[model samples]
Target: MDMHILQALKSETRTGNFVGIATANLSSRSELIAQLCEIAGTGRLQPGLRILTDYVGASHYLLARADLLQEAGLDFVVSSDWPFDLVTNLAEAFVGGFGRATELEKCMQLFQPHFAVLPETADVPDGASRQYCSLMFNIGRSRLALMFLFDDGFILSQERLRDVGLLTAYYTSLLQYSGTTTDRDFELTDRELECLFWIAEGKTSDEIAMILGISRNTINNYITSVMRKTATKTRSEAIAFAVRNNLV
Candidate 1:
């Protein structure tokens, strides 16, 4: 199934108003990695690709395999309690379709990433000056995140980013049909989901209690349950998770 997806991707990555290929020239997944290498002028390819379940801080991923990026401490992202303040507070428009990060200087402030541990093959330039592009696809109740890395020399045009995002969404649906999706969501009760939905809409516990015809204490309890199940540290974090995962 992955091969078939890759084969389809070969023809899907071309970016143009109908003319040229992007800098990545991403004919295949390997080519995508090679493009990163080419952009960095590294002459060697050690790339990382993590297709996440959400564009935000995600605990679970659909697929994770990146030997190249693990050098920079990216491998620890899922287990770490690192805060993604920007992703949690992203505009609704960004999450609804496709979006790219790091191209616009102002938006870089949203995501927090520690420096990459430089690989043994030091072909690329300084890690501090590297360019990272994360492509996100919002599919129904599911979201897909693809993270790309290269040096500052790479010119990431918006058109190329959009093409990558669209092609990635294509593979996301294929993965779904092939049953590559696993550990989708922690089991949240109906009451917990209801509470999360209301909370996302700016409802307080007392308001949710009145709306659900339940006691405020019960409303709080349900929220607590949601927090516990989602492994979120705070109510705000839990709500962010709900919104990112389309649970609300």
Candidate 2:
């Protein structure tokens, strides 16, 4: 099944429509690797595995940041149609069964290679039950799960799975950045970021002005400028957006 997939990929590449083949003029392995590499780029998540899944036969994929688990106070699950019930149940277990330290340790330990079938009790979605292989691996600061619901006979390689892990981490990290309160380059100014931090901490413009030794009017102007630049409205909404995008 794996070889067949690769053959299909090669054939598709020749046809000139394959997503992974657009830059096939890549002359060397390093060039190929760079083209396929999404880890170091900036975004909420990398698109490498997502693109791979599309090129292959998988319907959907998910990559969760292990480090985010600490700040979010929850285990992150990235998969397609993984039942909300299943996610809630497993998240409860993750919360109860492991401490922050333990979870981090587990993520670190799995960095090389790992994959598995979800337990029978796991309430996988109807769409996912046929092929029904939910596998996980860790890479750098994140953990990822790739669940495929294609034909039962379909098989993916260990090497490919490792690539999925690496690619997923890259995507997830990039996505994490996209959702962060800070932008990748230039970043918000010190004053702007200071205001944002305070807003997230529940400070009002008047309070921020007092803290920054500026007048309330000046603080309001700064906030208005921030809203325009960030393209957000309402302080609370802005803060939420910042936090979600990893801007803060």
Candidate 3:
């Protein structure tokens, strides 16, 4: 199916409102991934890129090069325990809270970004951390995150972040069409993926229930269904599977 860009971008605002976009027609999926790898290596994008996918029957991810992040005193979270501490912490500490489903849309509507900040924290050791900024976003079954390490006096404004997020979504949509995030069988229903998405975001069962307007037990059932389907033993392992497989 072909996705209309303006229409989709117009709607990247909240869950249950996402519109499907067409795959990349300009570049091969490999070429695009390689390009991002080069960007990650160059430190132009900062600590790294984490591309998470939740689709078909699996969840998975691909991290940008590690050497680049090493220079910044950071590393990708271990897949099994990918705490994603950096994302949660950055949102809370710097931006007050993670912005809306459509962060940019909300900003445009309200005339203020959900979270925009200066990259001038004094706690960054040796100024390594100050150069970089982080944000996360979603498009369909995929979640895209990029951290940009900018020159002094430069900031990753909310508008720019949203732009990057959309671009990242474009690239990952290509990956999805190219079958890059799939390997084997693990059938998760739509309900299961919804539960997994919120779980990966650090939402508790009760919180997810409230957000989805479902009962707490129903949320738990969805999660347990995910774990069983994915052959995971614990909630974290199930989420880890989701992350690595790009299911969430």
Against the true structure, what is each candidate's TM-score?
A: 0.38, 0.44, 0.43
lDDT of 2: 0.49
lDDT of each residue in 1-248, candidate 3, tens digit only:
11111211211221110122332222333443565666543433222233212110001222321111121212223221122443334433332232323545423432121223433433322222233434444446443444443222322234434544555555545454444544343477778888887876668899999999999999999998888888888776776676556565
Q: Write the per-residue lDDT of candidate 2 for residues 56-173, one digit (tens) a residue.
A: 3444454443333332323244333434655554554443433444655565655343333445567554334232334456443234555543333343344444555555555555
Model 1 scores a C-alpha lDDT of: 0.41
> Which is the winner by lDDT between candidate 2 and candidate 3?
2
Q: What are the runs in model 3 whose C-alpha is more than 4 Å off? A: 1-95, 99-138, 141-145, 153-166, 180-184, 187-191, 194-219, 229-237
lDDT of 1 by residue, 1-248 (tens): 10111112223322221122233333444454454444333211111222221112122122211111112222212121112432232212223222233334323422222122222333322322222344444444343345543333322334444545564455444433433222546487677888887775557899999999999999988988888888887666775565445454
Ranking by lDDT: 2, 3, 1
Least lDDT summed over 10 consecutive residues: which range in candidate 1? 1-10
The parts of candidate 1 lying over 4 Å away from their true place are: 1-137, 141-149, 157-159, 170-187, 198-203, 206-215, 227-233, 236-248
Better of 1 and 2 by lDDT: 2
The lDDT of model 3 is 0.44
Pull out the clashing pairs in model 1. 71-117, 72-116, 72-117
